[model samples]
Target: MLKKYSATPYVIWSILFIVIPLILIVTYSLSTKNPINGQLVFSFSNYRKFLELKFINVLLKSVTLAFKATIICIILGYPMAMILSKMEAKLQKKLIVLFILPMWMNFLMRTYAWMVILGKNGFINKLLSMVGLNLNLLYTRGAVLLGMVYNFLPFMVLPIFTVLLKIDNNYIEAAEDLGADKLTVFRKIIFPLSMPGLISGITMVFMPAVSTFVISNLLGGGKEVLIGNLIEQQFLVLNNWNFGSALSVILMIFILVFMAFINKFDKDNDDKGGVGLW
Candidate 1:
C-alpha cells in the first residue's frame, strides 16, 4: 500500500511535467517544417542541422565559459568556506547571510546592477576617472566571466560552507595535538572531510553557470552568443522550434553525462575513504 501510493504521485508528476514535455520536445526535434501548413512533420533533419560547424562552435564557446566560471568559483569560494567554518558561530551566521543576501534580490535586477557598475561611463569608470585613469571594460569576454562568477559565487559558497560546518573541530585539534602545522592539519584532515561540500558546490555552480542566458545576454550585449543564446534565438526569434528542441536535448545530455561522471568519481572516493556525498 505504501509503495503503491508513493509510486502513484511519482508517476503522475513525471508524466504531467517532465515526461510529457520532453516527449513533445523530442517529437518536435524529429519533425520537419511544413511551410504550407506552418506545422512540423516527422523527420530527422533538425538534428542534422545541429551538427553544422557554426552551431558546434557556439556550443563549444558556452562550455568553455561555463568551465572557466566554475574554476574561478572553486578558487575563491573554498578559502571563504574555510574561513567561515573557523569563525565563531555568530560571525559565521552573519557572513552566511551576507553571502546569501544577493540571491534574495531579483536575478535580472542584480545583473542590471552590474551593468550600471561595469558599463562604459559607469560607476567604476567614474571612480577610475577620479584617480586620473580611464577604462573601457564593458561588452568584453572578461565582463561576461565576471557576471557569471558574481551570479554563481553564492551557490558555490553555500554548499561548501554547509559541508565545512558538518566537519568536527575535534579533528583539527587532534591533528594539532599530534604536532601538525596549520597547513598540514588542513591538507590532511579538513580538506578531506570537506570533499562532500566541494562536490556539491561544483555541481551547484557548474550546471547553472553553463546554461545561464540572461547574464550573458544583458551583460554581453548580444556580441557574445553562448549556447543558451543560440537556443533562445532558434526557439523564440527564428521560429525554428525543431532546431531549438534538438539544441536543448543536446545540452540536457551533456549535463547528464557530466553529472554521471561526477557521481562515479564520488563513488570511487567513497569506497576508498568511507566518505558520504552530502
Candidate 2:
C-alpha cells in the first residue's frame, strides 16, 4: 500500500506535463479559429491546410536532408566506434570523453560556433583567402548538413561503441579457430550483434536532424527552411496556433511511423542472422 502511494508523484507529474500538453495539442490541431470572434472551434481544416504543395515540399526536404545526414553519420561513426572499441580501456575512455566534450556545452552555443566557423569571414574563409581560393561555404545546404553531423555524431558513436564493447571476445576467438578471417568474423558475428546499437544510433541522429530548425536557420542562413522552421513560424510569427498544432501532430506522426519502421527492422534482425536496414 505504501509503495503504491510512492508512485503518485510521478504519475501526477506525467499527467500534468505530458498528458495535458498532448491533449491540448490534439484539440488545437483538430480545431480552427473564428476570424471575427477569435475563438477556437473544432475542425480538421488545420490538418488539411498543411497538405498544400509548399508545406509538402518542406516536409520532403526535411526527410531527405535527415536521411542523408544519418547515412553519413553511420559511415563515419561506425569506423570510429570500431576503432575505439579496439583501443585500450584507458585510451578508449579518454577518446570517448574527447568525442563527446562539445555536447557538454549548450546546444544553441554549439550551433552558434558552427555559424561563426562557417561564416564568410570565419577561420575557414580566411585560410582560403590566403590561398586566393574564394568559395561560398556558409548559408548553404551543405553547411546545414555539416552542422547536423558535427552535433549528432556522438549520438551515433556512443551507442554503437557500447554495443561493440559488450560483445564477447570468446565469440571472435571461436570464429577464428574455426578458420574464419577477420572480415568473416565481423560479418557473421560482430555486425549482427551490433544491430541494436546501430538502430539506436540511426534513430538518435535522424530524428534531431529532421526536426532541427536552429542549424538550418543559422547555418543555412534562413534560405533553407525545414518543417521545424515552418512550425515555428506558424506558432510564433504568424500566431496560428491551430496550424502549428497540426504541424506538430504531423511531425509527431512522422517520428512515430519512422520509429515503428525501424523497430520492425530490429525485430527482423533479431530473428534472422543478417543485417537489416530495409
Candidate 3:
C-alpha cells in the first residue's frame, strides 16, 4: 500500500544518520590500530583505559554537576510553570516569548555573555567594587553550574507548563466536591499528573548538562574539566578517534541508564494511577 511506502523516507533517514553513526562509533570503541601496519584491530583497550581513576573521576564530576543543575532547574522552573499555567492566556504567551527570546541567540554567544557577566571587573565585580568589596566570581564550579541552570531553565519550564495546561479543571473540581482541600487536590492529583513533564524536563536538562563542553570550558575556564572536555580533546585536539569513540560510548551508556530509570519511575506512577507521588 502507499501508506506503507510513505514511511520509507523516515526509515532511510534513520538508517543513514542514526543507525550508521552508532555502528561506526561502536566499531571504533571496540578497535585499535595495529602498531606494525597501522590498521584497526578488534580490541577492548579503550574501555579498559576508561577504568583509570582520572577518567572515572571526570565522569563522576560531570554527572554530579548535571544532577545539581537538574535539581535547581526543577526547583526554580516548577513554580514558574505553575504560575504561567494560571495566568491569562495572552499574558502567558508574552511571558513565554520573553523566556524563549534568549534561546534564539547562538549558544556560544550566550555562554560568552555569561563569561563577561561573571568575569572579574565584569558587571557584578564592578558593582561590588563601587561598595569597596571585590570578589572572584568567574572560572568557578558554581559559575559553571549557574550557567547550565541559566541555559536550560526554559527546557524545564516549558514541558511542565505544557503538561500543567492540559490538566483538566474538572478533575480538580470533582476532588473539591469530594471535600478535598487545595493542598490535597494538588498532592493527590496535580503533582502526580505532572510527573511525565517533570521527567521529560529532567531528561532534557540533565543530558545536555552532562555532556556540555562549552559551558564548562568558558565559564569554568578549563578549571572544571568534565568528561565532555576530555572527549573533545580526544576527537578534535588529539585526533584519537578510537579513544574518543570509547568515551562517547560510555557516556551514551550512562545517559541511557539514567533515561531508563526515569522511564521506570514514570511507569510505576502510571501503574499506580498517577497518585504515586504521595
Candidate 4:
C-alpha cells in the first residue's frame, strides 16, 4: 500500500515541469498583444503568419535537411549496429563505449569543433589546398547536414543495436532450417523485428535534427535558417514570445503526428511477418 504513493512525486514533477510549461506555451501561442491596452488577446494571427511563404520555405528546408541526415544515419548506423550486435559480449561493451565517447562531450562544443574543421582554412580545405586543389566547404547546407549526421549517428546506432541484440538467434536458425536464404531471412524476420528499433532511432535523430538551431547557426553561418533558428529569433531577438510559442506548438504537432505514423507503420510491419520464416 505504501509503495503506491511512490509515484506521487513523479506525478507532481510532471505536472509542475511538463504540464505547466506546456500550458504556458499553448497560452502564449494562441494570444497576441493588444497595442491599445498592452494586453494579450486571443488570436490566430501567429499561426497565420507561420503559413507565409518565407516561413513555409524555412520549414520545408529544415525538413528536407533533417530527412537527408536521418537517411544518412540509417545507412551508416545500421551497419555499425549490425556489426556491434554480432560481436562477442566483452567486445560489444567496449565498442559501445567507443561509439558513445563523442556524445559525452558538450553538444555546443562538438558543433563548434565542426566549424573549425569545415572552415575554408580548416582541416579539409587545408589538406586539399596542399594538393593544388581548393573547395568551398563551410557555411553550406551540406555542412549542416554533415553536422547533423556526426552528432546524431550514435543515437541511431545504439537503439538499433539494442534491438538487434534482443532478437533471438533461434529465429535465424529456424529460418535457415526452413530453406530460407540470408536475404530472405533478413527480409522476413530480422528486418521486421528490428523495425521498432529503427523507428526509435528515427524518432531520436529526427526530433533533434529537425529542431536544432546550434548546428545550423554555426555550420550554416546564419545564412541558412531552420525552424529552430526562427523560433530563437522570435523569442530572443524580436521579443515576440507569442510567435515563438506558435512555432513551437507546430513543431510539437509535427513530432506527435510523425510518431503516430511511425507507430502505425511498426504495427503494420508486425503483421507482415508470419510463421513462414520459422
Which candidate achieves the best TM-score against the true structure?
Answer: 3
Model 1: per-residue Cα lDDT over 196-220, one tens digit each? 7788788888898778788888888
Instruction: Give the Cα lDDT of each candidate.
Output: 0.85, 0.91, 0.93, 0.90
**Estimated TM-score per prediction?**
0.93, 0.94, 0.96, 0.95
Q: Cα deviation of 270 in candidate 3 (Å)? A: 2.6
lDDT of 3 at 36: 100
Tens digit per residue, CA lDDT, model 4, 83-158: 9999999998998888789888999999999888888889988999989887888899999999999999998998
Q: Candidate 1: list runs displaced more than 4 Å.
A: 2-7, 274-277
lDDT of 2 by residue, 87-189 (tens): 9999988998888888889999988988778788987988999998867888999999998999999999998988888888988999999999989998999
Cα misplacement distance, residue 163 of candidate 1 (Å): 1.0
| lDDT, residue 107, model 4 | 92
List the candidate 2 regions with Cα displacement exceeding 4 Å: 1-3, 272-278
What TM-score quantifies how close candidate 3 is to the native fold? 0.96
- The regions of model 4 sitting more than 4 angstroms off are 270-278
Cα lDDT tens digits, model 3, 1-278, are: 99999999999999999999999999999999887998999999999899964699999999999999999999999999999999999999999999999999998999899888878889998899888988888999999999999999999999999988988888899999999999999998899889988998999999999999999999999899999999999999998899999999999999999999999989987876653212
Per-residue lDDT value at 109 in model 3: 98
CA shift of 276, model 2, Å: 16
Query: lDDT of candidate 3 vs native?
Result: 0.93
